[model samples]
Target: MQPDDVRRTDVSTSPPDVKRPTRRRALVAAAVAAAVLLPAGAAVGYAYTGEVPRGVTVLGVDLGGLDRAAAGEALRAELARRSADLAAPVTVRVEDRTARVDPSAVGLAVDVDATVAAAADARPGVFARLFGSPTVDPVVAVDQGRLDAALRAAVGDVGQPVVAPAITYDGTTPRPVYPESGRVLDPATAAGALRAGWPDAREVTVPLLDVHPATTTADVDRLLAELARPAVSGPVTVTTDRGDLPVPPAAIAKSLVFAADDSGRIEPRVDEKALRSALGTGLREVEVAPKDATVVLDGGKPKVVPGTDGQRLDTAALGRDLLAVLPRTADRRVAGTLTAARPAMTDEQAAALGIRERVSTFTTNFTGGLSAPRSNNIVTIARDVDGTIVQPGETFSLNGHTGERSYAQGYKDAPVIMDGKLVPGVGGGTSQFTTTLFNATYYAGLEDVEHKPHSYWFSRYPPVIESTIFYPNLDFKFRNDTPYGVLIDTSWTSDSITVSIWSTKIYDSVKTEWGPRRNITKPRVVHLEPGPSCIATNGIDGFTQDAWRIFRKDGKELKREKFSWRYDAEPRFVCGG
Candidate 1:
């Protein structure tokens, strides 16, 4: 009935770690217990008294005798109270921005009943039974409500459902966000985060492309409308390749649309205005069809070669048209010019020609001296018959283009030019033809790309004056000087071998006049053993000459250039003494 008795019982039953109650409260509680206990036996009295059971107290509130329902109700109220107490918006900082959200946003709930239930599991033991009344055990369930509140407070606002805004990534360089599940966040994820972080966000339509062949803007608009509703409660249809795809309205509304940009980049977004605008534009019509363009090879309609019946040149035309299409002068347009230019040769001419009608040529193998005291222009004229043209970017191969020299190709055995002396030979006197072509190219201002010098001296071909042709190794090559293609024209007579270069020229006139051989330097002497058959000729010694050419335009000299030539004397020997 007294404080001393209450103290004796409490001390015996109280947990060692638990602090004793305040003296005033302890005394009053003891008195109340005695008043009720004196009438009934101590056990019955305490049971009926409904006094504060021995257990842990939370904020001075005892919750010992309550049943499960009552305890649960009480716990719920406490959780609600705690939630309200912490209702003040929590300010969370991420990056450079701060966000505010209520603690309840993170799902915090409190249950006093659970704590009581746990406490009931921890009943007073033998010590309490021996010395004092049995004490109620106190257990605490994790304050899920409070914990959630704190977590939400820390996390800021997360709008919609727990899994509301899902992120879709275009697989581009998207901003990074870490998901709780340790996955990478895509654009859709970023959108979801934005929704969770921002409250004033309005509904926006995200335009998405259909994977199917056909889809209408109205269908997409309807889907958007359904998503824009207050709370998406049911499934909705979204267009797909297979057919309409039924998806949650909430998912659709907050869903990010993936659309390809001009660069084929998938962009995830949810802009209703932009979405509607895009859908209105409709699908892009197929642009250019796949087909082969006609290009003429050589000129005229390319003749189907004997072996190439079903095949034709890849291009529409060749020669002039080809030259026009190739990289050309600054002012000329390749495509336009090629379309307008006519084929270089007629169809009949091409069919008659062995190779197409562009140019026919053959090489000469001359073994004797040019202008051999016995050899003359007749042999030279007869050997000259082939012609050629230098297309842009083409390299001139004298022997390859001219072809081999043989009896089968109309070549006859005659005096030919070789190392300075005349002799009975085949394909002789071809140098005149080569020299003539060389002069033409030189006068035409074309590039003298490759040329071989004669092995012996020649009055006709002073150094820088002659071009030699050998079956494969020796050659004379020149590039066309004008933007317009150059055509080689060859004609032969008993007295002359003429090789003319015909092409369009920008220059009104190209004239060549020899400049005085100036800066005369002494020639270097050369000595060598002579062969037994070699004949020593008088007055033949090594000489050096630097000659100048004055190129004239109309009448006036436009440029003056020098050409250097070095000659070594031939050694003489007696064949028969």
Candidate 2:
């Protein structure tokens, strides 16, 4: 072969001088540039993309490759289809009763916006953009209030109210009523289960919760066993400083009270008011009232009687002690303290009452038949009116001082003037005492507040200067107008009654002037049936008279007072006619 032919064959056989390293370097640089450029391009595309990544699903509905608005529309369309499934009423079973509930009425709704957002969030990363995204569940919202309301309405008619335990006492025995349990739907739990299974399952079982009563039968039983039985087991004896009072078991039982405390426990106690009432009458015997000092006439001179201190049981403290001891087994005893009560008027105060000398004296005579009853009545009145002190600025009432002269007060029936006629009545001779007291007050220059005259004129009493008094209806009142206190002293004999006023003399002298009788009225005779109650007396003519009282100091007239009296005619009554 020739040299050129050999050279060509060598060149073909020597791999033609190929640059493999350079080719490999160029391929590697091209691959690196493609990795960076592709990722950067994808990032820019993702930043500007308005569509959701691929393979995203909401409630099993595909929402991929769609814009936000388009995704929301797709989710809403899928939810609307699912809502058709929810249109079928779900059957709710509670215990033995069953109710059909509409999901829409209970505020069951789909959140399309949230579902779309969840789908968007499930988008694949840039590297994973070539792959599928993860499956996501849509967010569902429910109105809890509306759901609970619908559930309550479904079970309202079938539910029973819970009964609370109670205890009632019937005199000697205590009865207890047991509590009853009630069933109600648990709104939260039942709603969660219902919402999770809604638009899919045709029926759902509602969870039932138990309602417990505040009190139970065990509580009542515990009260009866621990408190009531022990309280009524035996009698309680309450002993004070004076004596012991035995209260029977029945009474103690009535006083026992079983009440609930703040911790819901029944506690035993004694009824305070009932126990106090039971001991009221017994406590009265242990009480002593205070007596004020009195002013009395001793040998025609004012003397002070010393006041006395009183003692009374401390009922409140005794009640507390009794409550403490009453719960014991038997023979319970309690002692009460005696509190001292001071008298209103002390001996020194009584001595300071200015009653030094006799200011005035007056006497009235009764010349008629002085029967034993009439004499007894007069003596009784004099005894009552004697030793009564009239303080300064105080008014003395004859009727108030001398109470009603009934047979209960040891007064005998005698002749008394009534309806212009003398009739048989109790306290017949009291009018004479009134007249004497009035005249004594008049002569003493004391002020007279109120007084009434006799119905007819009488020769025994002064014409217009006398006064008469009956029971509560007619009263003789006089005010002590002096700066010093005045005391009344009364005495009576068989024929006359005397009333004297004792005080510091304020006036020098007192004189009275009388006017002649005028407007005379004749008496009329009347016949009456004879009986034991009939009374026969002489009648008198009626007239009007005027009198004046003149008070003098140091022989000079201080003041002059005028008084007028009008009398009615008294007709004579003839018995056995």
Candidate 3:
């Protein structure tokens, strides 16, 4: 082998005698050169070219700059200049109201400049550094963008402000604002507004009320006119018994007034006028009435009086008697009663009973007889005509038994006291009748339940046994003490009065047990001489006695007690002709 051949072999074996390009080596060489060249080129572009990425937008404003950072800074400055005036408070008007708010309070901010600076300071990795600059800043959008949008929307809708006018309570008339309380609304502005906005489902009405002067008759007339009648939608008239009178629905409504003022409250003013007109037009009316009592003889059998144009009522006489009784009639009803139903009596029967002889009687004035309070008349006749029966444990009331007496009944005036003076009045002597009956009842062993004393002492009657009565307040009462029923019979004569009892005989006989008249306190007596013009009178001493009687049945001891009798101690006046 020659030297050349040997050398070639050595070179082939000696790991590449001549240089060969490799994949890794080529890549490194190219990258180093590009790195050096790209920087230089970028430097040149930045110095001369104003080119920027196509999509580069800052704050929604498109721009061209040396790089993303520079563009961002420029955008921030522009935004700051545009929004500088919005940092302060802004005023908005709505109706009559005004409101002010700081723009910053509504999510507005001046931090854009600082945010841009931070973005400019951020750098990418080494590879991206070699290529191109990173995006200027992560798309900086307004913070709380949605919130700001909402605030802006609200501000856009703000309207003009409103001013309320002042109110006053004038003195025209102090009246309730809500006259119809039920349908009335609150007078407050807010409440009124709400109510006006939505009326109630039901029918509503408001009544107007005001006060007026009531001093003049004219005022009263006006009030009456106002109260005339109410215009009622329903039936218009009603009837009453005082003859046919008219009624209007409106009038009924007028009867009740709303809250009255100084003058008076008038209700349903319109309705009242309408009702009055309707009433004046003459509606048919039915007569309202009361029960009419008819007097009858013997179970309602009436006998007609012969004359007087069928006007059965004795008006003239009744009026005078009523006038006399009126004063005492206060709080009391005028009443009388027949003892019982009576069968008609023929003349023969009346004679047999001696009624004519028994009833013809009169009493003298107080000078010669009992005083006014102790006088009696009606009860006596009642007992005599028809006996009264009182049962065991029964109380007899004079007023309860008697009924009202008017011109319709058979009542005639006797005599009575008027203003403390004697006058002709009906039922004047009735108490005398009651007194006689009372004495008979006492003798019959009945209990004296209630009795009133005379205002003045009377010397002509039995001091211990006499009784008197007025209508309701003053009454004579007694109870039947006996086990059986007792009947009373009374009779009268020109000179004397008698009362008898008819009943089952409770005892064989009743006798008074007399006490000795001892320790007599003699009273002074006087006598006067007779004169031509005046009659002379002698006075006697008064006397009092205590006595008792025993009741026996078949000789058996039944009851025993004391009885008393008293005469006025002053004396009795005896007159002589």
RMSD to the true structure for each prediction, in A, is 31.0, 20.7, 32.2
- Regions of model 1 farther than 4 Å from truth: 1-387, 412-426, 508-541, 554-560, 571-575
Listed in order, each prediction's TM-score against the native is 0.32, 0.54, 0.31
RMSD of 2: 20.7
Q: What is the overall TM-score of model 2 with all chains considered together?
A: 0.54
lDDT of each: 0.43, 0.76, 0.42
> Where is model 3 more than 4 Å wrong at Cα?
1-392, 398-435, 451-475, 482-486, 522-537, 572-577
Highest TM-score model number = 2
How should the candidates be ordered by TM-score, best one leading? Answer: 2, 1, 3
- In candidate 2, which residue pairs clash? none
State the weakest 10-residue window (summed lDDT) of model 2: 259-268
Q: Write the per-residue lDDT of candidate 3 for residues 1-577, one digit (tens) a residue.
A: 6999999998888665334546668899999999999977765554333344323344444443435567656766666676645455444332333334344554434355554554445444444444444554323222244323433354443222221111111221112222221111112321222222211111212122222222333433443333221122222222223233333333434322233342333332223343334354342232112222211123322222221111122222322332233223132222211122223433333223211112112222222132232233443336434545455678988766765322244445554434332345556665565666666666666677886544323554454456666566678888877665554555544444566665445556665566655434544543333443222223334456665656677889788766565544443222332
**Higher-lDDT candidate of 2 and 3:** 2
Which of 1 and 3 is the better model by TM-score? 1
Q: Give me the runs in candidate 2 sitting further than 4 Å from their true place.
A: 1-285, 319-331, 367-371
Per-residue CA lDDT of candidate 1, range 420-533, in tens?
Answer: 543445555555566667776666666668776664456655455566675656777777644544556665443445565555454444444443443333323333245533
